[model samples]
Target chain A: MIELYESQRAMRNMRRAAMQRGVVAILDVGSSKIACLVLRFDGSDPSDENIGSLAGQSGFRVIGAATTRSRGVKFGEISSMGETERAIRTAVQAAQKMAGIRVDHVIACFSGAGPRSYGLAGTVDVMGVTVDEQDVARVLSACDVPDFGHGREVLHAQPVNFALDHRSGLSDPRGQIGNELACDMHMLTVDAQAIQNIAHCVKRCDLELAGLASSSYAAGVAALVEDEQELGAACIDMGGGSTGVSIFMKKHMIFSDAVRMGGDHVTSDISMGLQVPTATAERIKTFYGGVVATGMDDREMIEKGGETGDWEHDRRTVSRAELIGIMRPRVEEILEEVRACLDAAGFDHLPSQQIVLTGGASQIPGLDGLASRILGHQVRLGRPLRVHGLPQAATGPGFAGAVGLSLFAAHPQDEWWDFEIPVDKYPARSFKRAVQWFRDNW
Target chain B: MQPLSRKSQSARHDPAPSRLKYRFERLKLTPGFRFCIRVVLPFALSVGAVSLWFASDDNRLAFNQMISEVRETVESRPEFQVKLMAVDGATSIVAEDIRKILPVDFPVSSFDLDLGKMHETVVALSAVRDATVRVRQGGILQVEVVERVPKVLRRGDRGLELLDETGAFVRLANARADYAKLPVIAGDGAHDAVKEALALYAVTGPLKARLRGFERMGARRWDVVLDHGQRILLPETKAVRALERTIAMDQAIQMLGRDLTVVDLRLTQRPTIRMGEDAVQAMRSSNTIKAGGE
Candidate 1:
């Protein structure tokens, strides 16, 4: 617990330092690729005038961006520190060279780590005056931290809502006269070792780790529109090694989970089913991967060339329907896992059940229709928002995590560290408020 | 414990009907259509991309050339080129400065010019309060600027700077002589409190000839210094009312014309006056002489 607090404090100081330096790097380390974006801050805080709309417009610009094939990473987690560090260095160095400047601070996002969300509530008596910064801090401290078992650490602790007396949903409770001040905070916890490994990997790349966020949350921030973010939406980032799911409401991520199966599984299945090389299987999958098969597929044939020294065997072809048969079950399984995660998150209770599919694997032609049927929600394919100077290749759904990481670096949502928590009120194990928080929010 | 178990089971089973309905609705999509939409089309598109990749010897080069050509044609249109720039709502000197800092090349495509960045660059100038940049008809890049109006000439550690009505620095002046017509203020933070100084100056309009300048005391309140060596200490808040009262008292009793060194209006309830050494000596001698005469 003490280690968790120390890590949070260190991250906060690093974030402040990054903002002061006027330039920072956003690194998205995934199984398929490692992307780096150099963001130049104009030293203006994101104003509350437009709120959710245009939040990412005025604060930062992407001066440089670069992506390289990832190595030694599997399921969005660093499998080999040395290899991942080399890949990160390559990506970051290219971006820095293009940006014509060196950045020491970097904020990274990944899709693994088994993220879990908890809703915590806290209430405190306003210090007899208007609700001030100290009062808000005290209330945050008053929220009970749940026992998330061993080897787990908190990633994001955000104040999602504030209530002053009987007035609920106050975005900010400062300067308001109230006898009681209460807050609803969303806390996301992940495996501690997963974060430490990434931190160690980044340190090896000679960059300071300023912050960390789940890639699913980052994708939600990037792909969903303002209305989707406010009204409630689910973002499913289908990547090479894993599929990440996150739920957003009022522009804050309330729930997040990830499935270990991803597009790589589908490729592996195809390779095994067709007796082809992994590279050839990936190429065929990208060109012909679909969950639905039609009569036309049976007529359309794909040449399966091989270099086994048998000319006749090398020139053999297979019907596209056979390929579809190999791919559909894995994609369906991944969606079913996503649906289970969403159900566990109580996603149906939200006012809007819009599901946005993003990331590289989501480019499949009819995944949205299949996902809509399976997830029982209105589904749409999402790509990263257009950012200035972004290369054409980096505009695809594959770069959603990277683009969202840039936005997160520019205008980070207010977190627990931004407040001065009262020293006297350590987090208590009050299960009552936790239950009440779930009742009030869910 | 039995009741709790029953409640949990009930909660888990509650969504069965909705789940059945959803499944039934999804079953409406026939297998053939689903297979076509999901599998066949995606396979065809991927095969097409693969064929395009394998067909040409310089596929990447061709693609790059095509993209560049399309971009060039779109950007090179005459309507997109900014032939000239016209700066409005500024003096010739300020307009020249605006042009110097803009860093834009003539006959460049307007699409290449980031108007928001240009506006920020123009607003960074000390003389500009705000600026708006737009492309007009006939390939003209029009820039409209609102210049900060200088209200006071402040002489501080950084030398003389013109201050706006809000006490913000507008621009630097070479010397106080250049802006001698404007009211002068000195000391730290005087540039930020030009509003109060201007208000005091307004109230002392009748005595403008005798007023030399205003000095900021400790970055709070003000000291109105007169040419005849009289200093009026104004309170931090409601200094205008105090200045008005002082002016009224001076008009009623000729208080300012007397040889008073300081008028302390910091305590508004009871105003105190400090006499000059010579005036005190003269009063003392007159009182003694009157005592001797009696």
Candidate 2:
């Protein structure tokens, strides 16, 4: 835990250096595509300061953006280092060209890596009459870190709640009269090997990994609105090889997990059913893929074009209803897995169980209708929030991960600080001041 | 089942740039590198090329030759040519002297003419007081000379020379008879006091018939010399007034017509005259006879 903590702190320092230089690159490495956005910070807003409606971002402009199809990546994990490096080079080089600048520091997000969330509680007696930062630190260090397996590393550890004496939910216990201080912290851990792979790939591309974020948490920060996050909401980010589920309450992410199944599975299912190539399967799915099938879909046929020597084989077509039939089950299976994770996390107990569906795969027609039936009643499709200088093509739901990574770059500690936890050095507060961690950090 | 993904994907080259190409492009995009290429490189190249071209002696000589040839062609044009020189407002003798001093041949380019130097050369002639040299229309080099009018003649060691009113030498006079009507001033510093001499001459109204010239005495005072050898020695300051007093005494006593040869007005309270030898002998013989009779 100490080792990862120091590395995260170093990455935070690199991010601060990038902010001082006034330029940073955001990379969202997903299985389907790698997106890069170069942002130029034009003002001196406080680091991790909630300056805008979305909590902790202000005075930044997107100067360059590019996306390339990902290679040698599956379920958001780098499968081949060399291939991932080349893909990253392609995106970064294109973005640098558009921005006409050189970028050395990068903040990246990924959706795979098997993230696990843990809730921990620790108590400490106040050393002085009133609790101060030292007592807060002591209580935080006192938290019993669970043995969350050997190979995993803690990505986020935050003090979620603080209680003094008998009163509970004292978000900031510093300088308050209290005899004993007890705190609850949320810790999210992911496979260490996955992070190492990402860091190595970024280094190979001549970039320094300034910060790392789980794409699910980034997606949750982007897709879930301010009110939904404050009340209670779960963000579902369905990508090519994985679907990310993240629950936010009182503006802090409590749990984040990824299901190892996504749009690629549905495309494969269609490819197998129609005896077509994967490329053709993807095109057909985007054109005719749906979750709810009707009688009208049977009449809508999609031609699967091919240049094979035999005419009879090249001209085969599939009805839209048949395509929907092949896609619906895989998408349902992915949602069912999400529902299970939410149920396991006790998502039903939240005050507002808003489920926001976003990402490339969420663009399927009638997805919200299907997700509402299985996930809960309050379900809607979401696109990433708008930012300055974003290209119209990148504002789609597919770029939620990339946009969220940019927001993460604007405030690097938002993902690593465990906002629900109240720590001093890494304070990215969601309910800060208990009054105005209002849009990002209070 | 037909599968054409491989053929289509293989038809086009990979969209991702190679590692070397990407690095090269990033270097190209760098602000410092871009500035080197965009501004400094071209400036340095052009300057180098120019300096290299100018390095050879033959090239330098050829450039200078081209410039001189262009200048010559423009200068030799008809509009710039001076066909002749015209000397205006001078006597024919003075004009001839002026034309002799100026050696400008006809049909020379006006650009070759140094008017300022030419004017100074013409004005330096004793006969010409002030002159202007200019190239007027119709290819004429016009020299307008203002010749000084001779006011007095000075009989000096180098012979008599005509002088203007300001005591400047106008020209050499061959003989005194050539200018018999002009007053003759003779003495070492008489020319230096021409204005005073002219003032004394202005008061010599009654003695005009007998007046030869006014001679400067000791370069300070004046001695009025008449044709009969009568001379009046006048005081230094207010010599003109002393000369007026002499003229007044001569008008009252007709003293200039007597045997008096010297009227010494150097001492204003005492009036003394030196007679001729015959007059002094006659006065002494008459006084001796009158004493013997008494």
**C-alpha lDDT values of all predictions:** 0.86, 0.86
Q: Please, what are the lDDT tens digits per residue for candidate 2 over residues A1-442?
A: 4566668878888998998998899999999999999999987575545454535555688999999999879998989776688889999999998898999899999999999999889999997799876677768878898999988988777676789999997867889998999988888889999999999999988789988888998888788888998899999999999999999987778888889998888889988999999998998888878889899988988888888888988888878888888888888899999999999999999999999999999999999999999999999999998888989989998899888888767755433232232344344553443443342353
**True lDDT of residue B23, candidate 1:** 33
Candidate 2 DockQ category?
medium
Cα lDDT tens digits, model 1, A78-115, are 88776677678778777876786777789999999888
Compute the lDDT of residue B102 as modeled in candidate 1. 87
Give every collision pair in model 2: A54-A439, A55-A439, A55-A440, A56-A440, A158-A421, A159-A421, A159-A422, A160-A420, A160-A421, A437-A442
Model 2 TM-score, 2 decimals:
0.83
Q: What share of the true interface contacts does each candidate keep?
A: 0.00, 0.83
Chain A TM-score across all models, in listed order: 0.92, 0.92
TM-score of each: 0.57, 0.83
